[model samples]
Target: MVQILLSLSIFFTSAAQAAEKAGMPQLDPTTWFPQVFWLLITFGFLYLIVEKIVFPRLSDSIEQRNDHVSDNIDEANSIKDQAEKKYQEYLSLISNSKKEAQDLINANKQSLQSNFDNKKKEIDKKLEEKMKEVSKEIDDFKKSAAGKIGSISTEVAKELVKTVSKIDTNNASASSIVEEVSKKYLKGLN
Candidate 1:
C-alpha cells in the first residue's frame, strides 16, 4: 500500500511540474517518452505477477476442487452399484424361499393324501370282512330257525285240529302238511 502511494505521489509531482507549461502532460512531446517508459514498466511488472503467481494459484485451487468433486462422484456411483446388486440378491433370496416353501407344501400334501388313501383302503377292507361275517351269521340263524319252525308248526296244527274239529290228529300227518306248505310258500326266500 505504501509503495503504491509513493508511486502515485511521484507520478503526480512529475505531472504537476509538466502542467506548468502544458495543457496535458500526456499530450506534451517533452514528457511523452518518460510517461510511456513508466507505463510499460508498471504494466510488465503486473503482467509477470499475474502470470507467475496469481493465475497459477487460482488454477491450482480450481484443479483441486475439480478432483475432489470427481472422487466424490466416483464413490457415489460405486455405492449405487452395490445397492442395486444387494437389491437383486434380496429378490432372488425371496424367490428361492418361496419356491422351497411351495415344494415343501406340495410334498406334505402328497404325503397326507397317500396316508388318507391307505387308511381308507384299510377301513374299507375291514368293513367288508365284518359285513361277510354278519351275513354268514344271519344265514346260519335263519337255517336253524327254519328247522325249528317245522316242528313247532306241526305241534300247533295238531292242537288246533283237536280243539276246533273235535278229532284226534296224528303227528306224522301234521308234519307232512307243514312241510308241503312251507315248501310252496318259502321256496324263493331261501
Candidate 2:
C-alpha cells in the first residue's frame, strides 16, 4: 500500500513539472504506462534496500538472540545439575549422620544395661550379707534370753525351798539336808 501511494504521488509531481515546462509537454493521463513505470522504479529501490541493508541486519539480530537463548539454557542446565549433586551429597551426609547416631545410641544403651546389671548384682550380694548378719544377731539374742530365763528359774526355786524349810523346821530332817547338799555339789561339778 505504501509503494502504491508513493508511486501515485511521484507520477502526479512529475506530470505537474512537465506541464509547467514548455519544452517537454505532459503525457496522456489516460495511459497507464507512467504510473506503471514509477511503481516499478519505487518497488525496485525498496526491494534493494530491504535485501541489502534491512534484511541482513534483522537476520544478524535474530541469530544473536538465538545464541543468547541457547547459552542461557545451557547455563541453566549446568546449574540444575550442580544443585542435584549438592542435594545428593547432603542426603548422603544426613544418612551417614543418622547411622552414626543410631550406632552411638545402641552402644550407650548396651553400656547402660551392663552398668545396671552390675549394680543389681552388687546390691543382691550386699543384701544377702545383711540378711546373714541379722540372722546371726537374732540367734545370739535367743541364746542370751534362754540363759537369763534359766537363771531366774533357779533363783525362784532356791527362794521357795528356803521358805518351806523355815516354815517346817521340826519336820525337816538330817537326810533331806544331806540330799540337798549332794545336789548342790553335783550342779557345781556340771
Candidate 3:
C-alpha cells in the first residue's frame, strides 16, 4: 500500500513536469525511469495473477478432460471385446446347430431308406406269390377246359356227321377224328 502511494505520487510529479516541458512523457528522458518502474510493476502484477489464479485452473481442467476421455475409451474397448466374444459364441452355437441338424437329417434318411427297402422286399415277395398262384390257377383251368373240349368235340362230331352225311357217328370214331384234327391244327399254329 505504501509502495502504491509512493509510485502514484512520483507519477503525478512526472506528469506535471512533462506538462511544463510541453512534450510526450514517454519521450522525456527524465520521466523514463518512473515510466519504466510502473511498467515493471504492472507486468509483475499481471504475471502473478496469471500464475496464481489462471494457470492452475487451466491445467486442472485439461487433466480432468483427459481423464474423462481415457475412461470413456477404456469402457468402449471393454464393450468391443465383449461384443466380439459374444459374436464368437453365436458362431459356435450356429455351427453346432447346423451339425446337429445335418446329423439328424442323415439319421432320418437312413431310417427311411431302411424302411423303404424292407417294404419293397415285402411287396416283391407278395407279387411273386401272387404270380405263382395265378399261374397254378391258369394251369388248372386249362386242364379242365381241355377235358370238356374233348367231350364237346365228340358230341359235335356226331351231330355234324348226322347233318352233313345223313349218318350218325360213334363216340370212339368221333374222338379219334377230333384228336387227329387238333394235332394238325396245333402243328400248323406252331
Tens-place lDDT digits, model 2, residues 1-190: 9999999999999998977774533455656687889999999999999999999999999999999999999999999999999999999999999999999999999999999999999999999999999998997986676555555545555566669775433323533554465457657955
lDDT comparing candidate 3 with the true structure: 0.91
lDDT of 1 by residue, 1-190 (tens): 9999999999999988877757765666998888889999999999999999999999999999999999999999999999999999999999999999999999999999999999999999999999999999998998888879999999999999999998888999999999998887688665
* Candidate 1, position 117, lDDT: 100
Candidate 3 wrong stretches, greater than 4 Å? 1-22, 45-49, 162-168, 188-190
After the best TM-score superposition of candidate 2, give how far the Cα of residue 15 lies from its true spot, in angstroms: 23
Q: Which is the better candidate, 1 or 3, if ranked by TM-score?
A: 1
Clashing pairs in 1: none
Residue 54 CA displacement from its true place in model 2, Å: 2.2
lDDT (C-alpha) at residue 128 in model 3: 100
The 10 consecutive residues of candidate 2 with the worst lDDT sum are: 167-176
**TM-score to true structure, per model:** 0.75, 0.58, 0.69
